[model samples]
Target: MTRSARRTRRALQAAGAGAAALLALSACSSSDSDSGSTTSGSSASSSSSPKLSGDVTVFAAASLQESFTTLGKEFEKAHPGTKVTFSFGGSDSLAAGITGGAPADVFASASPKTMAIVTDKKDNATVPATFVRNQLEIATLPGNPDKVSSLKDLTRSGLKVVLCDKTVPCGAAAQKALDASKLKLTPVSYEEDVKSALNKVVLKEADAAVVYKTDVKTAGSKVEGVDFPESADAINDYPITLLKDSKNPETAKAFIALVQSAEGQKVLSEAGFLKP
Candidate 1:
């Protein structure tokens, strides 16, 4: 072969080899870019919702004891490593505790007015949402021994009736119902919470007590529930929110979601609570 031709062929081979190397490099770069994007997307997905672990503390109204207990159990079962602890009492009392720097992740109140005590103090992390409602009912001794059929029946001079304190949701609702009927009631005693007032009837301490319908249902055979029309006018909306000082906000948020979920509503309904 001529020298010029040999040189031309050698240069052509060198150029071909360089092109192959460039193609190989380009392929590797493309593959690396795709792998990097996939890794980045996975990292984002995992970070957006970290695995929930830790405890959620809830302060709820007295009327929510049973239903909330059931929900707490469900939450624990759903999240293996998580737990829920509740402080149940009068709405006013719970709100006061939250505002007083009690360590709680969530707050569920029986009335908007009571919830305002926390919200007004800017103690809530989120806007309160009404999850349920309750109406007043007359709880009497089993079989309604007193035959307390209506709201007016409790006014009998000799019959002793118990009422929740006006500062509490149950008491406020009872008063509203009484006011709606243009009736006056002077209870033998005023209790701090619905459970306290209902206990009066269950223990036969009083002839009857005005409490929430849900509480009456919880009392079951312990007391008889008397439905009154005036109660409809005094239904109380139940609100729930995450606390601003929550130590486990993610878990608290999950619990709040569960409470507002369809399953949670089912449990509350079965317990005789009204939907929001």
Candidate 2:
């Protein structure tokens, strides 16, 4: 072979070697790009996976204690990285907690009248809406041994009774019903809440106590519930609101939404809360 032809062949082979090396590097670069894409996609998915954090303290009405507790567990289960702490008490007490800067994220009140204290004070949320309704009932010892069948029966001489103070919703409702019926009751004690009033009857502290229909339903074997026609006159609406100082707004709003959802409505209804 001639020198010129030999040189030309060597140059062509060198060019082919360079081209092969470039193709291999390109393949490696493409593999690295694909890995980067996968990593980015995974990061996005994880970031979008509901990063709800911080503790949410809820000050809710005493009537909602049982059902809200179950719903709280369900909420924590459904929402990762979120913790729900509940403070259940009289609606007035719960409102006081919220007003006292109790680190509460949400407030569920047994009465809009009580909630107005919060709402009227700060206009706390976007707006407060009714979630449920509850009315008062007479709770007596099992079988209603007192023969306390009606509101007028409560005023009978020698009958011992305990009633919630007028500040509470249950107490207010009781008063309205009594007023409607024009019956007078001289309760042995003015209790703080329906639960307290019911406790009085359950522990035999009083012969009869007026409490909520839901409270009686939840009391379960502890006290017998007696319905009166006048009770219909004192139905009260329950309202729930998200606070303005909520640290976990997303979680708080989500929790509120769940409480107002169809599932929550069913749970509340089953617990004797009237659907709003």
Candidate 3:
């Protein structure tokens, strides 16, 4: 072969090899860009989605039954694979259960004092946040047959009135309202919780019940609610907290957030609980 032809062929081969290398590099760059985009999108998705799952048990005050139950359903719906179980009763009793080592993930009390029973103990509770406030109301049988209107009317002779035991929040608030009006009342029975006190009137076992406004509302047509001015002097604040021994801290925290959220406020307000 002629020297010039050989050189020309060699140069063409070299040029072809360089072009192939460029194409390989370009292909690698494009593949890297797509991989990086996929990685970035996955990261964003992971960051936005909360990691919450597992079972969560909540011990709540009797007054929270309706609202918190509604919220629990919502929380479970919002977070798939999560279960919410509740034990509703007097705040004092629930507090004792927690401080006594009950397996509760969250504690929501009708009164700050009861929440203190948990928060006061070492490693028993997290700092509590007041989620709602409630006021006293007179819950009488439908139509208020006793003609009871004011706190003093409860003092009427022969009226079988029921009040929560003084140790509980409802009872404490009732006492405060009574003291504010400078009126004395002697309830026929001091029930353990507001629900029981309200039940007394509900079952026609008593003439009336001095209970939380929310309780009357929850009772629906079963009872009539009467607001007294003295209730303004004895508002009870409801507080919620995550327990230290929470089996699912993330789920518990999410539940607390749901309770304090605007959606939670709407549910609570609908149930007659005043905003905090």
Local distance difference test values of all predictions, in order: 0.94, 0.87, 0.92
Which candidate, 1 or 2, has the higher TM-score? 1
Write one digit per residue (lDDT tens) for candidate 3, span 1-276: 999999999999999999999999999999999999999999999889576899999999998998888899999898889999999998999999888889999999999999998998954557889999999999999998889989999999999999999999999999988888889998899999999999999899998999998889889999999988989999999989999999999899999998999999999999989999
Each prediction's RMSD over C-alphas, in Å, is 6.1, 6.7, 5.1
lDDT of 2 by residue, 1-276 (tens): 999999999999999999999999999999999999999999989888466676788888888889999899888998777889998888888787778877878988889899998987893765888999987889999888878888899998889998898999888989999888877888889988777888888898888999988989998999999999888888999988988888788789888999999988989999998878
Q: For candidate 3, what's the RMSD?
A: 5.1
Q: Global CA lDDT of candidate 2, please?
A: 0.87
Task: State the local distance difference test value for candidate 1.
Answer: 0.94
Identify the leading candidate in terms of lDDT: 1
Q: Give candidate 3's TM-score.
A: 0.85
Off by over 4 Å in 2: 1-49
The C-alpha local distance difference test score for the whole of candidate 3 amounts to: 0.92
Ranking by TM-score: 3, 1, 2
Q: What's the TM-score of each model vs. the native?
A: 0.83, 0.81, 0.85
Question: Which residue pairs in candidate 1 collide?
Answer: none
Q: Best candidate per TM-score, number? A: 3
Q: Model 1 RMSD to the real structure?
A: 6.1
